[model samples]
Target: MADKSSSNAYWKANIRMIQLFLVIWFVVSFGFGIILRPMLSGIAVGGTDLGFWFAQQGSILVFLVLIFVYAWRMNRLDKEHGVEE
Candidate 1:
């Protein structure tokens, strides 16, 4: 029972982290890239609107950063939960 509760807590934390990252991904890739693009147009990047930059490259860069962040965070979480590999 003890082990089961610990495992459940670990999984819950893991899922919560994933959900947060996914929301950020969606906002960056879709919201900034399309829906909120017009609002961001006033901001320029490399002679173009910020939205264009996000649609073309910024989102990909953000995704890469998020991947690393997730890895680093999850590794720390694993260590905290005594499940590091």
Candidate 2:
């Protein structure tokens, strides 16, 4: 049987990672793409405002990157917690 404390620690760590990724997703998709759009308007991106690029493409790219980052981090965490598959 797995040690209860170790299992708890692993779960906590997993949750933390998930939270971090969610925050990043929110920031890129909403903060940069919408709320801060006007501020980014002056910046050029593919002949349009930076905000447009973010809303149309940047957020998706960032999300993809975050997915990989989360996976990589979780893999390491799993190994550290002796829960790797």
Candidate 3:
């Protein structure tokens, strides 16, 4: 219910937040899980190598955390933009 410019700004901010979250998710799930596996092979996590752990579990955990974080952030953004219900 704000002005047109305010509405545009809200959408822009929302898109930016989505983009950032996607990038982080990609890095965690792809970068750490696959691309950087070799570099992380030496480290141990929960009885497996760091890379394997990331590929199997860490990425999933990170994704779930990101989901919660995104929801929380979006709520704040909605309030800021006067779009909350």
Candidate 4:
């Protein structure tokens, strides 16, 4: 046997990636959602403030993008590290 314990490592790395992405998602959504909205009040896109869009929609879009990106990256990492199924 050549030893095959890479799966566990890949799983852990994937989990770490997910956690990091989630934390960023939370900060962008909630932190910018309310707590920091005032500071960002001056930044406007069209007629809406940055934070306003973050709260109402931007965060959700970012989260979705993060998810797909995470998935794609994880797949690449796994393939590179010889851990994919």
* Per-model TM-score versus the true fold: 0.91, 0.90, 0.88, 0.76
After best superposition, candidate 2 residue 60: deviation in angstroms?
Answer: 0.8
Off by over 4 Å in 1: none
Question: Mind giving the per-residue lDDT tens digits that candidate 3 earns over 1-85?
Answer: 5577877898999999999999999988799899999898889887878888888888999999999999999899889988888
* TM-score: model 1 vs. ground truth: 0.91
Cα lDDT listed for each candidate: 0.94, 0.91, 0.89, 0.84
lDDT of 3: 0.89
Q: TM-score of model 2 relative to the true fold?
A: 0.90
Cα lDDT tens digits for candidate 4, 5-80: 6766766787898789988888999889888999999999668898999988888898889988988998899797
Worst 10 residues of 4 by lDDT: 1-10
Better TM-score candidate (1, 2): 1
RMSD of each: 1.6, 1.2, 1.5, 2.5
The most accurate candidate by TM-score is 1
RMSD of 3: 1.5
Distance (Å) between predicted and true CA of 46, model 3? 3.6
Better of 3 and 4 by TM-score: 3
lDDT rank order: 1, 2, 3, 4
Alpha-carbon shift of residue 29 in model 1 (angstroms): 0.5
Best candidate (score: lDDT): 1
Model 4, position 74, has a per-residue lDDT of 83
Residue 80 miss distance in model 4 (angstroms): 2.8
